[model samples]
Target: MLRWLIGGGREPQGLAEKSALQSIGEDQTQNPYTELLVLKAHHDIVRFLVQLDDFRFASAGDDGLVVVWNAQTGAKLLELSGHTQKITAIVPFPPMESSKENSQLILTASADRTVIVWDYDTGRQVQRSCFQSTVKCLTVLQRLDIWLSGGNDLGVWNRKLDLLCKTSHLSDTGISALVETPRNCVVAAVGKELIIFRVVAPTETLPRWDIVEVKRLLDHQDNILSLINVNDLNFVTGSHVGELIIWDILDWSVQAYELNFWNPSAQLDAQQEIKLCQKLNDISINHFTCDEENIFAAVGRGLYVYNLQMKRVIACQKMAHDSNVLHIAKLPNRQLISCSEDGSVCIWELREKRQLPAEPVPTGFFNMWGFGRVNKQASQPMKKQQEDTTPCFLEPVGDLIGHSSSVEMFLYFEDHGLVTCSADHLIILWKNGEQESGLRSLKLFQKLEENGDLYRAV
Candidate 1:
């Protein structure tokens, strides 16, 4: 729920398209984009963290307090508290500029099967909804003016905080995750299949939940753990079997696959012949990240970056983090930020300075370089003006403090504060502190864009 309210003006339609790769191999140049702040915890666990735009940031833990911090100063501003159980997810809704709303709203889902909407200005819950089933995943679609929530069931809620539409009918799938598109359609990974649903509030029919099965590619060697819509057409699906499959949403077919584990069947399952048993034994994909430039997926051991478009593995570092990564977020500026069960948060430079096979996120391949800007063609691959590699991971500029537990998830709100939630039962917010020296390296190409070292001379 990042707000484009950066002084709210004109937003370029979207990025152009790019090529979709099958796998990332070695020799591919790869790096991280933004500097990461590994917030240190002092108590139970630092469950999660998030940014609230440019104003504030929040982080939560089992400690109960949702610490709000200054985005630029990293000063603790306030605390958001109220949940009795573990907080699972946190999202910030940047009020529409036209609405003239002063403060923003923070929405949190907890293991208590409850969703709390907070008015950060006062650090209190303005409203809340209780569910009998645990809330597994959540995504807010402003385009459709609705919020989609999934747990034991998939449902939709309106801006008025009303349960406008819901159906326990999909209970069979036991929805786990959700992703929304520009058109406002909601795609959910529920049951044994990937279910696509749209929100429709007809003047005649009671708001309805339309379930469209995109692909029944079932018999998952294990549970369909997570479904991420990288962009509009290309989505990535992760399974308990450690096999992550990237699918072409438009065609409802598997475009490529990442095999971290063994799959019982080959259909749509990303399988590879890895002679090394250690690589596949417990290589869990806890997170999937894409710079819309290159692709990186987190395994049980470390992070694996590849140019799926070129089918080359750019970089694979073992023991980058202590445990399996819990989640990964690609920043708006094309940086990769991630949090893991290892109780650490890391930011990496994503732009490779040299040419590398482009393997953007599983789905955003079409929209990464602004491909879907015009809806050119389905089979079209994206090509950039330069084959030059851009430095990926810049460097960690700052560190966040407060959470006392394992940081499960963290996402930047772009020029705003960061929002994170953890199993510790609270959501922590991190305000973007001062730009560290690392940002200087970011201008490497831009300064050198015009002439080789001549731009620096002039």
Candidate 2:
């Protein structure tokens, strides 16, 4: 003020510059992923989780048991046991529009090389069929009454497990992921490249179904770890190289946007910048889920939010999980649910951001020797400033903790709470909106493990 008054009034320019600098000094903080309830889900490693309906979800484990749970109350609804080996995939059959049947069917593929169809409500196996090789993944095409299974080879089958077409011509490498598009196209991730196929009509020469590879997407430099179809024309993929690629089904020529976990800035110190670069190189996107305009990514142990249209990370929560975050799901209320190899499921809510008052610089503009006048000037507002500038961090609003070993995967729905499967070979159903103090559910699990004949010698 004294300088402005003495030097022909430069207050406006000086204040504007100060305001700009202050804004630049503000640091944005993200919310931590919290836990709600932990259900001891499986007796063996939970390999797959699937939502059966708005109120129910099912989990498959290495113990060869498929259990269904009520999401709202964390109650076990039914246990479907049949598979002899690890369950690799589980998917709910799409409802038939023309039929009036009330019961829903679930298809489970296993390392035993068989696909079993079960009446989820009755807990009975309705049908079963063996594949030529161990089935690693399954995608149901309900409109045509056919489903695709991938393992040592890829095969198309009817609802009755009658093999329609089987082919190994697509790749010498095994398929890792499978997704079907609205345009009747199937995208198969074979090692590093994606093979797009369309079913050919059956004829006399081939009395069964046939598929022809339409296009091969080879944009990724490393193995494609996960694939998801955003819409009929758009899809997203995460690679082993920590790259997220978005592609258009209609036009492969449209360049894919490769996004990374972190973007460093010029102001960061050399050591800090190098550490960030190394972190991104070490991290790989493990799973992803989308809600409206944003995509939630589980990159290593962190959670990142990317704007779909802008193609950039808007927010991130580092070290969301102590171990690799294997799966992430977005809740209806805009919170996120994540499961990790750390054996926990967490819930995170993004709070509204507010501009906090900036802190006083430790050193003065004009310092005497190496010391400054900050200590003398900071006395009045030090406590307030310290409280305001206490780096905002996301803390999990609720925590679920019962899994004994690595939590392999989970499925969640707004109407249903959460169902997680683990290496412990138990499946837990977490109820939505219910609050209990300090993992009371663990006792329930202990009692069940002791009394239930499922784990004891017959």
Candidate 3:
């Protein structure tokens, strides 16, 4: 089953001879990852992977070293070393037109309370600055040609590394995450609160740039773990508890709130089996990614698809992985990719399920959102509430098993393939088997023609 799911050297077989599981695994839109290349560079667990350009990406982690790799070929290009401690955050600095050449640059923050900007092409440290506290997160405001660093306080800087403005200390716990919103506003997740700040550039009357704290949101019940901008109109934040909130970007008001993740009656399996209980930590929203229509959430070991228009969970897998899911990414064509602490990466498709004419119409919120309905039996309430109300279900398509430890996160490079970093101290470049085979055949034919052997081969 594993071999067939990952397309492990198996030739295509007839549909008539395939099992139901094999038929789903062989769907045309299933995961195309078959060939893989394991890249080794960091000695410690790899935690972060950031793309630098179309064909290059960088990986950093507890090893205190950042290694750049060619995503297309999985070849190590440069090893950037300067940080004396584990890297906490990394973001790319867009190339400036004023430079002698449009050289790609990257900014990295470390536990050593310092941030360094490096020119990836030359492997040279361009600028370095010491911070009062370790920068936990970094956000680039490309429109303004500046960046912001969040830690004990929020600091804004320009391309030359000059501190333009900063805020007073707000929290000892420091800012866990930061995201840019429209209209020159920034949102910082500090402990259990969300602080909104507006960046004001110098004008004819102002004469100086400033960052002003606009509002404070005190809705989350626990520490905020994940925060991201969904679109120009709204942004979303997930808490250490099972709370997920969507906030209006302009007014900083709660647009939507969901706490149903902890409701035991909502946990339903494919066979309509009810999961009675879940630990508190298991329901924490670890990460979030989205497309235009839905928000994909990595909640504990499960993967959920929440529709923005409907404001409800349209599809979900209560136990998508064997362990806690660390990160998730939305792929094209209604597909999702999630990595877990169990040392595995799984691909899922949000396929629509046909509704039966005999099925009763759902009425309650739980049933309406596909959380299942209570059965007629009185004693088995847990087992009763195991039905679906939505029209979609997450189908397991492919499983990429190579890492020996936790798979931290991954970056999808389209034609270049998928790049995943792991706690096993390895980076695996997963490629489309069929596309790679065609590329190899094309290269061979080109070589044969160059050597004047094409006619003999034909």
Candidate 4:
């Protein structure tokens, strides 16, 4: 009778274990990363987001739904359904004026090991191409009408979905990131190594493209995360160990300045700070982007900005998110936008601090009032103007929160606003504090929980 009342031992092992874990409050806590309004987007966790243009964006999730949104009004424009598994990537194909048939298209990859090209405006799948393994990342060569898909191997294909070449010679460990070179070569990062492949093509070959290994640069001790093009001949890479390195494309040599796990900055001191650096080294770099002056790297839970001219880290904000920052994008207005595994989106702006006057102001008058001004001198407007113009630090300008689970990715649209996707199965459209409606909706669940009616409501 006791064994029967306890449900016996006949229950599946996995089910019993899951029930015990739930009873111990494994997944019951409320998500702490809420800022603005929330939108219920997907039936499962959102996985990727991409900006279609200045006004529209798309998000794909585990529910196999690709949702398009009007960036300005936060309205759902359309929902595309086709993939049978979790979506891996969503990339926007820039419009080609040369190809009249090519309007705007979106290319999406899924865990089903298939890449689907969709006419994003019409919400119709145009073509589908299968791969041998999961497509981890993708890059497009717009001028050449070619695209590279990276996974266990690298596959080069044309706009018509014809596979030009497939090669595993670059890296057996798998391609982590890909970039193009000025000399028509391809740079592939695999683990801690950077492999440069020179491309060759024959006018009448069955496989139209071929890649030959030219050079392999091995400077990092950890897995490389993201690669950024500083200029035509200069590039930068961030690693899983919080290391940043700049590479000269001409000679593929490392630059003088380096940000690594060993406290690359001479200003870093103290045992506690050193220990903190050690902990940071264990964290990973998730995304990277830059404008003309600064390189922004989202590493672990922090957002780090490095000054290119100064060749040093000028600002590092720890806990930019409660968890890992997954993606980052720089807006047209010089604002930094980032999303994280903590289910939060934050916007950052840079501004310079006013420089203190070199000469002291007159203090005699202030002494009489117990708040004396310093001695005054001639104005130095030129120096002050220069000082005021230089960007001193990155400051948080705004935050948009809505997701109940980890935010996978976010994209910024200039004509519209921001679009973010989360693991909570949500996609939120945010503007500049126009409407704050999620506050009431997010609280309704909490009220139910407090009243002990949450289970019944669910």
Every model: Cα RMSD to truth? 16.5, 17.1, 8.4, 12.5
* C-alpha lDDT score of every prediction, in listed order: 0.57, 0.67, 0.83, 0.69
> Clashing pairs in model 3?
370-389, 372-387
Per-residue alpha-carbon lDDT of model 2 for 125-235, expressed as tens digits? 989997767777889887776788888677887766677877774554578899887556788888788888887657789776787778888777678888887665677
Question: Which candidate has the highest TM-score of all?
Answer: 3
Model 4: worst 10 consecutive residues (lDDT sum): 17-26
1-458: candidate 1 lDDT, tens digit per residue: 12212122212122111111111112212222222222323234556566665666677655545667665444566767777776777777766656665667878888777888788878767888998787767777765556777887777776557786675656744677777643445567665466666566554565454534333455345556666666655877776556677777665577776663332223342433333334442566666767554567776746666565664345554455666777776665445666766556665544445555855444467666667634554556643211112233233322333333566776566554466655544444444323433345566656777557756577
Off by over 4 Å in 4: 1-38, 169-172, 201-207, 260-283, 332-334, 354-391, 433-458
Per-residue lDDT of candidate 3, residues 35-57 (tens digit):
76667778788999999989999
Q: Candidate 3: what lDDT?
A: 0.83
Give one digit per residue, the lDDT tens place, for model 4 in 207-234. 4687677888888867898887887757
The superposed Cα distance between candidate 2 and the true structure at residue 144, in angstroms, equals: 2.2
My TM-score estimates for the predictions, one after another, are 0.63, 0.72, 0.87, 0.73
Model 1 / residue 17 / CA error / Å = 46
Question: What local lDDT score does residue 249 receive in model 2, on the 0 to 100 scale?
Answer: 72
Strongest candidate by lDDT: 3
Q: After superposition, which runs of candidate 1 have C-alpha atoms over 4 Å from their true positions?
A: 1-43, 96-103, 169-173, 204-219, 260-281, 328-407, 411-458
Location of the lowest summed lDDT over 10 successive residues in candidate 1: 15-24
